[model samples]
Target chain A: MIAELLFAVFFGLLLLGIHRKVIARIQRRPGPPVWQEILHMLKFSFKTTWIPKTASAALFVGVVLVAIGIWSAALFVVISGGSLLVIFAIYMLHKIVEHGFGLSSGSPYGKFGGVRSVISAASEIPLLVSVAAIAIFTHSLLISDIVSYQEVHGPLLITIPLAAIAMYVVLISKMPFGPFSIVESKELVSGYKTEHFGVWRAGLEVCNGLKTYVLLLTFILVFIGSLPFWLTLLTMLILVITLSFVCALSPMLSPYDSVTVQTLLAGLMLVYVGVLGVMS
Target chain B: MKKKNALALTLVAAGSGVAAMALSMASILPGWAYAAVLVLAFPLFVLGLGLYWMAREGEEDIPFLGY
Candidate 1:
């Protein structure tokens, strides 16, 4: 378990680093090495730290803990092949983590970040549609069962392409600097994370690594079915690279534009789900 | 963030981490029991360790009042 958690922390950050490098290259600039995020996690952990005086002391610190905790639980759920709903629920809870990180700090930027996170809540509705589409096909919400269904019926990506696309959009939105990532837009000065420094920020980094790992792996397991261990790692690499390409080419949207885009996508997904539901 | 508080948090983190691993591996415990232990332990573990590391003595600048 320790080894698994460590892998999530290290390899997840490594993937993020690769993501940055890919984006930079696409934009014609050198970026940090693939190990930079891991180094960053360490660097933040060892820095001087303190709570902001204006902060709601308990909530300010509490959210960081919850951020890591929820993602860790998410990892376990994926590892155990538990209900997919649980993972989505945890992802929803992640919105609260973002909100808390911003509001509890008593900083205007952080508060705006928090508010944007909630507004961006629309971004996750397509994920719900995707999950519904999956359940419609498999007649089960359990990951283990879904994988078994895919094993017998071939990959869901081939069968329910729209759902796969919906889930992909979700993973994209979660990526840094993507069209919907306004909560952390530069105007917000790191957005929700502006106030969480030193060890606190390191903890948030740990959570993010685990989140990236779980979300990517879940997408693979659900849509592509399972693979051999090393193959699974390779698939994740390819998957993130694919996402990086999309992210690299796209410009960040204005917050309202982002919401319009997400809402429109969600509407399309809902239509797909509605059609799938009626057909099934 | 004091020394004594930091030490306590660290111990909680260490103990919780160990317990989570143990419960997951235990044949006698039900799966939900292990999950419950983990749900409880995880936040404590992350929070504890972060605070422990944050306990270093310093005369840092006041909180960001504004730019």
Candidate 2:
């Protein structure tokens, strides 16, 4: 378990590093080293961390703990062959953490980010729908069970393409770049994270990395089937690279626009799931 | 001395948590032990945060948003 946590933290940061490098290369520039994020995290940890006087002290710090806790739980669930339902619940709870982070800060930017997060919570439904679609096909919510099913019937990506597409949309939106990143948009001055600094910020960074690792791992487990540990790690790396390219080429959308597109995508997935339900 | 001790305890707790999980992954420890470590990890982390808060030199007077 400790090894898995280390792998998630280190590899997750590496993914962020690759993301930056990929984006830089796409724009015809040399990016920072892939280890830049790790350096940044270490730097943040060494800096002074303080709470804002005007903020709710308990919630301000509590949210960071919650963020770390949920992702850690999700990582454990995924690594230990736990239920998809539990993982999905953790994913939903993450929005609360983001909301708490924003609301606790008492900043206008944070409030805006918080509201946007609420709007984005709509994406959770489609994510649930995607999970339900898998459950329908596999007849189990257990990660191991789903992987086993895929081993016999081939990857769900081929069998249930719409569900895969829905999950892809969710993954894109959850990632830092892309249209759904209104929570931390530059115009909002880093949005929900505007007030966080030093150690608190470092905690958030680690949470982000864990989230990336867990989400990608969940994707592979559900859609790509399970592989040996090394192969799984390699697959995750490749997927991150592919996603980084997509993020680089895409343009950011307005909050309203992103919400609209995501909702439509979710609705489409639900329709597909419903059709599949009727057929099966 | 108290602050330093708290910091050390935080590190120790975190390290033990990681070590517990690692050992479990390697099958050297029982699965239940890993779960127990996992349960303990968050509180230890929170304790560290609390100690850090207590040890922090000063508080930011400025509001989160420059009002």
Candidate 3:
């Protein structure tokens, strides 16, 4: 099981590398190799590190532990086919981690990143709607039941693609360089991640890698149903490629614009859920 | 001393991982026991791995004495 955690972290890092590579390629620029993210993690790990002078000493350190802990918990939840609600809660907590990270640093840039993370909290609502849509259809919030449902009824993608779209939007919003990614935009000097250098940064990268894997896996299991291991990875790659295209081709939106887009998407998701509620 | 601290943490993390693995393979144990180990093991692994790397050789500074 611990081995599986390592696998998810490494594979997710590779996926993130793939995301960066694809985005760079789309703009006619040569990109780093697919393993760059893994190397990046290693590089960050070996650097001398200390808490920032102006930071809240305990929260700064505590938040990194929380980031890893929550994600690992999410991984276990996903793997055990546990409640989707728990995953949603963890996703929500991740936003708080971001908000906390910024304030912990007391850096202007970090604080702004944290505030933006809060403002962008609407991005998380679409995920709740996606979960709601899934619950409405399957009549159960457990992931195992949902996958079994796909087995019988075919993938949820065909029955209610709107939910999948909403979910994908949620995924896109969390990814780097996507339209709603204002928190980590270049100007913030790495956003909430600004002060978390060296081992702390490496830990964050591990969390990122795990998060990428868990979210992609959840999407596959929920919408596409189960497949062989290799095939599942291929599907994840395809999904990442699709997201990379969006991140690559589209310019990052301003915070207000990002919120507007999330709001519109959220409204649409709510309407779909409402319609489904009425129909069923 | 800092190096020893890093090594100790890493060893503890590795020990936890080993314990978790062994406990998982044991059919006699209840499922919750393995979960209990996981709750302890995962953070130790992450923190151990992190601090292990963060520790620098030959860079031990004088301890900051509160004025």
Candidate 4:
């Protein structure tokens, strides 16, 4: 557990490094230095933060803090051999609480962001269902048990291609690339995080990074199974590269369109899961 | 701005490096399960990077935008 937590911290910072790169690519102008994200975080952490006069300062901070807390709970679920259902519930609850924070901000941007979040949350249901199916099939919700199942039954992907596809869609939906990024639109003035600044923003950014690593770890551990220690780490590296290219090449889909795509993706995946279940 | 884009691209390239490592690991492990890890490993890593960068950008504060 300690090792995973440490990795999450390091991986989260590494993500900041990637952000500097991504922002550079999106805008035509030359960007900051390579290690700019780290610098930005350092600066933000030290800077003083102000609460909006009208804002419920406690709730504002509480929402983001709780967001981190919920994510940590989800990660702990994976580490401690808990029910996948519980993890899913915690993840969902976190989203809801975040939405409440956005709405409470009483900013137009925040309201739009909250609405976008609702859309995003709705799309997550199918992914959660697919995960449940995997648990049902493997007869356990524990990450290690699922890994063991893969070792004995072959990688779950080979047997359940649709489920794999669904999982990917879920993964994509969670992060919001291009069109799917309803709540996080670059054009929007801060989207859900419009009012936040300084350490609060930094905390949220770090947590977002941590969530990314945790989700990736979940997918890899569940579907990929146990690799030799060194090799397992290596495969993780490769997966990140492939995902980055996919992001670059794939045209950004609008959030509304992403919803349509996710729906279709989910339906197809459901059919595939049904078939797989019957076959096995 | 161009520099930022280049940096992002470069960091993504690093993600590829991680993927390569995963491939080699999958090869040494027992069975196709390991191979599957090799296959999905790089993409998952990229996904992580993508989510972090994309989501973090959402947190930027705009001056003219209503708080």
The model with the greatest DockQ is: 1
lDDT of 3 by residue, B2-62 (tens): 6668678778877876776786788655655666566566666776776776645333232
Tell me the tens digit of each residue's lDDT in model 4 across A1-280.
3345446755655654564466456555475665665565556654545556556657876676666556655666666556667666766675676586566566677777778778865567666767857965797877778888899898877766666666666666555343366776766676787766665666566566667776666667777777785676566556555554455557767777877787776676677667766777
What's the best-to-worst order under TM-score? 1, 3, 2, 4
Predicted candidate 2 versus true structure: per-residue lDDT over B1-67, tens digit per residue: 1567757768877888878867877889998677667655754564474455443545576654453
TM-score of 3: 0.94
Residue by residue across A1-280, what tens digits does model 3's lDDT show? 7778889999999999999999999999999999999999888888887776667878988888888888888888888899999999999999999998888977777888899999887888888888988988899999999999999999999998888999999899889888789999987778888878888788899889999999999999889988899999999999999999999988999989988888888888888898988998
- Provide the lDDT at B10 for model 4: 42
Clashing pairs in 2: A1-B21, A1-B25, A2-B21, A2-B22
Tens digit per residue, CA lDDT, model 1, A100-138: 999998888899999999998888898999999999989
Where does model 1 exceed 4 Å of error?
A: B23-26, B54-66
Instruction: Give the residue spans of candidate 3 off by over 4 A.
Output: B55-67
DockQ of each: 0.47, 0.38, 0.29, 0.03
True contacts kept of each: 0.41, 0.36, 0.33, 0.01
Question: DockQ: which is higher, 2 or 4?
Answer: 2
Top candidate (lDDT): 1
Candidate 3's docking class is acceptable
Model 4: DockQ score: 0.03
**What value of lDDT does candidate 3 attain over all alpha carbons?**
0.85
